[model samples]
Target: MPVRSPSLVELNAFLAVARAGSFRQAAQELHVTQAAVSRAVLRLEQELGQAVLARSAGGVSLTPAGTQLRQLVEKPVAALQAAAVRMRKTPERLRLRLSVVTSLGALWLMPRLEAFHLLHPEVEIEFRQYHHDEDFTRDDIDLWIAIKRSAPQRWPRHIAAQYLIGREVVAVCTHERARTAQTAPLLLAQPLLYHSNFPDNWALWAQAQGAKLPLQRKGAGFDLVMNLIEAARSGMGVAIVQQCLAEADLASGRLVIPVPGSASTGRGYFLCRRRAQDAHPAAELFAQWLMQQAGAPPTV
Candidate 1:
């Protein structure tokens, strides 16, 4: 026998009867006559070749087939109803989805998000975090903030990339460690913290100071900047991190820059978007605001 598809109306009628256990009650809930609800379910049974409901003097009860069908369609039907309601409510509101690095999202973006919200209460923001080398093309992301050695070259042809902010790498430690009599050599002897994504940060800083780091230096490694910064603040190790991420910790006296100066990594943060699609108005505004906050001039 051929598998017949039941209409959404029929499925809805069946579900109502199954939930209420009475065709009359289901009809009342659906704003239809009891006979109409019964006819819809009968038509559904004919298509499926199974008697789904067992009518009783008290009320209708589900047969075995009806129980299985109800279990499968219940949640999906509810989800569809919910989606319809949401569509009716905010069909025009702009939903801007962004992908950002974990550390940047936690330390920098989250703090400044309130300002964006206050400026555009109508816009909704969704955040997605991507770690090292994760593919962004399939993510359906509206915008991306990425740290790169230079402008990205491997992005899809439709993607537009713009330089956001250049980062300065600095070595930081807990306030207690900063208070100790520490020299560059002494600091190198201490356990150094490293980011898994940027493992050579300490070496890069050492190179900027015209010194070669020892091959056997002790250190702890973390996959995220926030974790590395926290580890440093907890006195676990000395952390080499971007100046932007440590600014708050430094200002609050939780962490201090043990090193005197920063190293230029020839790298920077970039804002990326798909060029073929019209930019979401909210995303454009947020991008401009981000540039303003980073003190970078808007690109033409």
Candidate 2:
């Protein structure tokens, strides 16, 4: 018997689940509910009369049939999505989708967006949070504010990349935590916490400071820099944080910059988008406003 065609929603849900390996994560990726994703996958399984995914305590894995289906439909679905993007009629209202790195979005931009809304009440911004490891080239998103580690020049050539803030980092901890740093080499013996994305941050900062920091795998690590900041502010440990994001905390006395010299991690946050002509007008407006907000010069 021929494999019956699955609904587009079912196929999309299955693909998201397969890529993420968890229905909850897939729902997040698809911006849908976990139950909705589960239902779609179940409907797809029933339509196929076979299990496509193997769910376990660890997570989810693709079955043989799932693997085959993914190999067949992934490119087609991507093309379909791209085609839909191209086919969308430009809305009369100036609206655009902007994907922002999670930490920056929450700590940096979220506070400053009211100004943008006031400046361009005609423009509407749809916000999405992006992760470090995920694909960044979705056509549906009009702009991306992302962190680039090195050679920011080559990222997305032929596109606009305005480096908002140079990756200037500082060692920060609550004021009370600094008093207990008797351990030699500065904060090494403390309950050192870090954002998981930059596991070598402490080592890098130490290296930049002309000190040796042994590889450390101990203590709490968080995915979001905001959480790392919270943990540090709660006196959990010293965290190497991006200075731009930690400015408010440092100013408000929530977090204290304990380290003497700030280290440049060679990472920078960039405001990126398609070419001006090809980009949404609202995205361009937001991008320009954002550059001004960061006090970074606009790029052509």
Candidate 3:
């Protein structure tokens, strides 16, 4: 006779028995009788034409075939269980979860969020800051804002992205420093503040201006652009930052561009989201609003 396939009930019973090492214990765990658990496991063994468990006075133990099956199904079963738990915990309200760089969130998005709220009061928003690299597919992120030299070549195939705005890097410092320095070389001589993520920003800006910055100079380094801007504003040092991030400070006279020209990094920010059969209404609304704010064409 040909071997038959085991049913889900039988497989679950076998797994329970293998884990507990006893029909009585497995039955207790499953809230079923010992005879029912034994019958289920026996049915599975008969279908597969294998003695899946060994019975002895000491206790029950899985045979080689049972061990192999357990190993194959454990991860998939765990994943299903986890997915079910997530579905149960998800809220009913429309929520958009966005992951963004710390500086952009603080300087640009936060200031404009209230307007979005007023317009779409029923929609909820959650912002998460990722200071380091992240796997967008595995995280519970609904969308992401990424800054790159150009469109990323190695992004996951499941994600769709649209260009938002090109970044213009400019050197900025307090008004006092601006008054003291009349030339690019003088500005470069001050303690240069550095953004940890874009450590070569100043050097790149200098190279764009047909000048070379000394790499040997020591400066205060901050992981977040907002902190670097604050350091520059406090007169600690001159910092090379994205022009968009310091627009308010520059307009308010708290900071000044020490250099006359800004360097185009040939880079821009991209709005990214997973490709799905249908877009979430809240996410779509926010994405469109973001594009409008960035001066980009609205996403369809």
Candidate 4:
């Protein structure tokens, strides 16, 4: 007889634990009891005939087998779940497909989505996150909340755009680093942190302010905004990033803006869609809700 594969539930539980690195945290994330999560992992281990995870006081670490399995299954599992959801939705349900760059999606949108879900329980929203760029050609997406330059004249004529918020770049570092307001001299004294996708951010901000920042750069660049933020919080260096993405930390006193005046780098966020596609009702509702949340005018 062929070997029986682990069930999806078991794989999901295992993946969740691997992600969280603790059964308790994974259980909380999955909205299940800790005992249930433990049982699922146990069942998976029994099926595999070996230990996949190493448990200890420091928390769980994946074994060699677990690491291999996680690499193979993570994307496939998420895709399977997404496909299943599409198949399971009823005709009566209103669904909206939306895309956005990863930084804005994680830092800004995800935290505020609960309110939208509360207000419009009947509308189902699907979020597709892109790491580097916005993809407007995907036929299934109803709308895209994208980060783009403020110049509407440059936008594709075939796309309809709504203004959201301008991107204000701020230089942030720990209190230990910046005893006073940020200046070009003070900023250049420390490492200049940047995001890989927007490598020109520091240059843009400097030019916007006419600060004459160095043409050649030094310091680290992170592909993910979260990593850059954490690096700033850890006092790795002064990081230039969008203000909206770092507001939570600034409010909590985890990070402080050293820049005397945040500079707009001639870019902003816009809600966009292809001109040819008919808008979904759910997309309309989401767009309205998002505009209100963003305090932006409804039209471009």
For model 4, the stretches where C-alpha displacement exceeds 4 angstroms are 1-92, 129-135, 149-153, 180-182, 215-217, 296-300
Please provide TM-scores, in order, for all candidate models, with all chains considered together: 0.62, 0.61, 0.62, 0.62
Tens-place lDDT per residue, model 4, 201-271, is 88777776678777665789998889999999998898988887887778778888876777766677888
lDDT of 3 by residue, 1-300 (tens): 964657767877888788657887677656678999999988888878889899999999988998898888755654554344335565345788888866677787777788778756656788766645666664667888877644234666566666676467898999888877557777777888987866777887888887768767767899878889999989998888887788778878899897788887766677877654143666756775676688732111
For candidate 2, which ten residues in a row score worst on lDDT?
A: 275-284
How does model 1 score by TM-score? 0.62
Question: Taking the tens digit of each residue's C-alpha lDDT, what string does model 1 give over 142-168?
Answer: 889987744234655555566676567
Scored by lDDT, the top model is 4
> Residues 78-164, candidate 2, lDDT per residue (tens digit)?
657544544558735678788888878878888788877776666778886675663456677788888886543366533556678
lDDT of 2 at 201: 75
Which residue runs of candidate 3 sit more than 4 Å off their true CA positions? 1-93, 129-131, 149-153, 296-300
Better of 1 and 3 by lDDT: 1
RMSD of each: 20.2, 15.7, 17.0, 17.8
Cα deviation of 136 in candidate 2 (Å)? 4.1
Instruction: Give the poorly placed runs of model 1, Cα more than 4 Å off.
Output: 1-92, 129-132, 149-154, 296-300
Model 1 residue 8 lDDT score:
81
